[model samples]
Target chain A: MESHYFPIVYLFGNENLAVNLSNILMITVSMAIVFFVCFFMARKISMYPTGAQNALEYLVQFIKNIISSNMDWKQGKHFVMLGLTIILYVFVANMAGIPFELATQDHVVWWKSPTSDPILTISLAIMVIVLTHVYGIKMRGLKEYGKDYFRPAPFLAPFKVLEDLANTLTLGMRLFGNVYAKEVLMLMLVALGTSSLMWGIFAFLPTIIWQAFGVFIGSLQAFIFCMLTMVYMAHKVSADH
Target chain B: MSIFAIPYVRMNDKEANPLIQEFTWLDAIYQLAAFAVLLLLLKKFAFGPIMGMMEKREKHIADQISSAEKNREETEKQLAEQRRLIEEARREAKEIVENSRKMSSQQADEVLASAKQEAERIKETALAEIYQEKTQAINALREQVSTLSVLVASKIIEKEMDEKEQEKLIQETLKEVGEEL
Candidate 1:
């Protein structure tokens, strides 16, 4: 009962599929749209300036302004590109789920935010953690990488591995918990609104505001995730870090 | 339909318990394969080139902004220097005009004083010439009056004279006639 995150996983059809194929499609499509929009916005840049360039400039400035303020530019410059992709992609994917509804089979939720799923959140967190290690190795050679694991003592290397693992798992779990809980609340609330008449009118006012709030939270969480990625990298890569 | 309920919301509700089932290793493999395919597709068509360009353009923009800021600062410095130079030039021009004005006024005052002194000296010389002519005319008048007095005395005298005296008297009479003429 506790493990069931309704919107995250569901049956596809009588043919049957493992994951919620529809929700997964929503995620993939949303991510693709994020990628293409960012790409298209940046493809051409005029020396003078254009709308696309202006949009891209703002995106870049926004990321750099945050990254540079939070970390050293030399160590941090390479990070914004990765951070932007992750943040924008996740934000769009999360918000896209709000509008999802099923018309065919009444039981299925047509779409779900990818972050609401353990698999998606865990995958992303793993990506960030793996990248942190990869960048750490690149910045400081593999010798330093293994050596840092011993920091206080060589015997602590195993502990460091466990710590990193724990850290990654927490990252994924925290995101999944929040997104999944939000989806659950939304479903319950929406179900409550539709089950009656007076409740429906009362629910209408809040639903619009709550959906907007959801968008804000979705964007904030994505930003926080990306920001933490860079912060952890800054700690891991540099010797003084 | 049963797969969705594997993580069933209700453990006690008989409605969902029958749907709960253990996921097979084969299903996990299928999920892995599907994920691998998604990753591959993402790598080839989406993440690879798009991420590359995004990074490239991002770097280019950051560099351009920093460079532009540097140039703007340099231009501001140059502008400040030029402004200082222009101010100095204007100050010098004002000083030159003031000096020229002072020198011209001093020269004009000196010229007026000299012209006035020259006019006073010319008037004094003309007055001196008039006084000298008056003195010379007074001496000529005295000589004519004495000659006329001598002629009246000779006409009143009734006496004979020697030849030398008569000649002296005739010369005196001729002198009186010349004075009268």
Candidate 2:
């Protein structure tokens, strides 16, 4: 297997590092792309939306709908920016792997999906959850926020605490797992087909089909991630709900 | 060590599989910073201006609709006033026609009454004149008859009485005769 083509170690360092620099590079590039798209869309906003403005309006309204549905718009409006950032960043990061990766002279994979890295997903998850807690405390005060854990029954406080941990874990792991598996499957298919000429031609159909399915899954996961983040925030920020 | 050594130091070969990477603080910082920057930029350029434009357009439309409604109401009110004026004029015209008809009829009645009175006065003057002429003619005839009677008496008596006695006798005879006629 040519799996060694992906660098597992730092190209220059002797110290123990788990993350590859190339993964970070790809994530940075994906972020840049997301920034560019947003900047461009925002350049010519008008009272009457046309073409790209229409699409931008749709995206903005979509995020607004997700927020307003969960809680009062006054409270939920703050989360729109966070939600947009997550959806756009995750989508772009997820799509990074769709194109064939460029190989370096030292056999390091140049561009792979950033969401495939557990580090990025975990970071995003932690960030989202942390923000919810921060906003919850800010909106409800510390005493009120603390009282939320003992609701329904006082005995369930431990489980409630565990729920927070579990929510973050699942949120991060779900995205990481799906995106990683997609890349692994593609890698396996490519590896399987390229070994033999007849297998390569036959494998083309499955790879092409999986790639199309991957695009759908990628977008769906991004949407789900954003929606869940908003739902969790809404649960914490809302006084009664 | 330089500030850049942190990423490399964090990137270790202990987990040689790049696919399975440990969570590092730097990556979290980067992601958070990247997101923060994105949020700031988008909030400034995209959501702020777009929502404002939408609100502006909404307000403008509302204003236009309200103004149109006001104009329509004004036109309706003006039309009502005009109709009222027209109705008033029509009513006044009818009254004027009725008054003229009443005045002409009164004048005709007055003129007819005056003509009848004038004809009656003229007929009365003519009747008075005819009665005066008849009375004058009768008186003249009476005088002539007296004179003729006297002459006849003188011829028949043939101066039988004296002058004084004759005057007295003539008066008596004239009186008697006048009475008999």
TM-score, B chain alone, candidates in order: 0.49, 0.63
- The TM-scores of all predictions, comma-separated, are 0.57, 0.79
The residue-by-residue lDDT of candidate 1 on A184-240, one tens digit each, is: 667666776887999998888777777776777787787777777777777677776
lDDT at residue B70 of model 2 (Cα atoms): 100
Tell me the chain A TM-score of model 2. Answer: 0.92
Candidate with the greatest DockQ versus the true structure: 2
* Lowest summed lDDT window (length 10), candidate 2 chain A: A5-14
**Model 1 bad stretches (over 4 Å):** A1-19, B1-181
DockQ of every predicted complex: 0.06, 0.31
- Go through the candidates in order and give each one's C-alpha lDDT: 0.66, 0.79
